[model samples]
Target: MRETSATRRGVLAAAGGALLAGCSGLDEFGESSDEEIRSSRLPDLTDDGESQPVVVETMPIEIERTVLAERVQRTTDLLATLPMSFGADDVPNGYVRKQLIEAAEDASEYIQDARTAQSRLTAMRSLQRARSEARFAAAGWGFVEDGTTETARQSEHEAVIEDANALRSDHAYLGEDPVEAVLFHAEVEQHLAFVAENRYPSGSVNTDELLTVAEWGEHTEYARARVDDGRYLYDRFRESLPADAGSIEETLTTAGESLVDELQRRRSDLPAEPTEGDHELVWRLRYRVRDAAESSARYAGDEPGAASTVLRGAEGLADFLAYERIRDRIDDGEQFGVEEAADVHDARDQAVESVRTALDESPRAGLARPVLADAAQQIVAADEELARLRGTVRPARLDDPIRRYVTATARARSVPAACQEVLDTLTQ
Candidate 1:
């Protein structure tokens, strides 16, 4: 039987509803309460009188390990580059030295925690705490100053102390480790006392303009450093998961599906033929879709994997949808790329291929077999419908363009949920 757009949209919508029902909220990274973690049950493989073969994948461990390694590397790099001594005098005063030592100690403790962390969730939370400590330690050095008179030097010292306190408070997340915060505050107070007694030489005093430049430079550098460190940590965190990590692929796929649904909800607000006036909306949608796909792909762990394939499909679909919108404008005689239709066609093909590949490589064993089979069937049906829509041209009012759009949108949304279903079954 030929698949009409109406029939296709209905099927896709039903599949999406079913997929959404099975998916959980995307709040996995929050700091789990002790009670929650303690109450969480490990997977049980025994059923009836038979022992089912269940394989525990090491992707989670790999993810944890990579995060730890990156944190260690970043903290070590920052410590090495830390300005232990400031001002005209090369040697740091006792107060400055004390703060540096405290920072070093906190960093050391963080390294130990990262190394000893037993789980991925634990490692992530630990890393966040460690980063906060490192930031506070780094901010301490920004207080160092040189001024000509006792009063001027005292004023500068006071300002630095104030800024340090503000910076520390800005990093309240690090307060999760109270000892680290207490030590940081103590160092600040001690440093201020030492500065009161020992002022810089008159010759070494910096002008107001120079001081302003230096202060801004210090703040800018600190912000940039933190950003760089965060990127390094997060990139490694995402890259660490191995392809075989239990149900990670399914988790990622479901996330992608959710993202697509979110996009559809937003797209509904746009006119049938969005114009250049809607450029901001289009760009925002594009970015959201890209972010969603990238986030989902991270769970794929390594390259050339199922999650990666689904990510590719999601991205292709995004591109297709954007181009389709452009094509809609072209139908109104607007100056748009004539090649958009071809681009949409190619993107759809890529999405179909990637989805099929993910389904093919997905594991179908143990307790997850039935669920996986059901998901596979749904994906196959969606894939078939997408294939049928592939050759159709744009702006045909008789074929119901809105229904076709919904069908395509629904299929994209369904992929992730289907992928997640496989993971859910395995974990359960």
Candidate 2:
């Protein structure tokens, strides 16, 4: 993972050049007016001649392969400029340099694999992941370099502010009380303070701990990714959404109240103290659910999908809690019993059935296609992991068995939330 001297020089040279090239403008994000939003096409979640509106996944554009190849080549060219090896002393930030090399190497591997990827979506995911990682590493190197002065750093921060503002504005244009967009909007403001004032926000990222420009660049990309994710989710649910403000607000209010009630029931079911392992894990999960409930209470009445988002989060917490609960019960060196194996198999079967049923019934049943598609994808992953479980796990290794079992169960448990979210979304 360590960079060679020549590699370090090449990476720094490329990144420095990028710094000089300056930040791109916000025009790429595109602007949407209220009129445009009202007339937007409903997402194509069904097919011609289809009796049922199945879980239609977002399809790649026809030119995706060509575009992806070009992107991969660009990423490859950027990393190819780096030399093969370097000493720690060659760079001021050895930790960051090592990370840069690792990221570059990973990007290279992804680029290679992407060339022959069977699935377009798979290839796109890998390429985007690689690009983001490279950008993060490049930013790290650019900010830590001695030549990047305070003026340069401040300029980069300003660009990030513009990026955040543009993303927020686009989210606002959705105008259905996009919960994640609002939350991310608030988050960017907090991060802005962190970068500009050296104050830490409640979020995971601490801007003060890292070089200001590096943190700003990293967070800007992070926010961009989050905003993109939210857009995709909303698009999935927006196909059948009512156009009037009163209907949207009423649905949100009812869903929010229901979500809060559900959260309360789940909270009440949990033991006051951990009956098995460390209390901190349980407490953390509890707090997360509590936080989601609080957020649901605050925005559910106004935000279009806030209740559903909170409910989904609460379900995820439950899944994690399930994993931790089982993990603590498992003893090191103990053979994973037939009973546990049966449980895992049962969970897998039920999850698969749930996803299948959702997909099959969605057209006639009015289930949300986005949630069903998401659940189907998760189940596919869980099935893949479960398939490899038998010969791979060792009786003496707790970590392996724990991982295999918990991963399947957690993923399986998460599938049901899609139905709940759909129900909440449709509530009047």
lDDT leader? 2
Candidates in order, TM-scores: namely 0.23, 0.48
Best by TM-score: 2
Model 2 earns a TM-score of 0.48
RMSD of each: 23.1, 16.7
TM-score, prediction 1: 0.23
Off by more than 4 A, model 2: 1-97, 110-128, 136-146, 172-250, 269-336, 339-421
User: What lDDT does the true structure give each of the candidates?
Assistant: 0.35, 0.40
> Under the 3 Å rule for N, CA and C atoms, how many clashes does model 1 have?
2
What are the per-residue Cα lDDT tens digits for candidate 2 across 193-223?
A: 3333432222344333334444444344433
Residue pairs with backbone atoms closer than 3 Å in model 1 (clashes)? 253-416, 254-416
Q: After aligning candidate 1 to the native by TM-score, how far in Å is the CA of 148 from where it should be?
A: 16
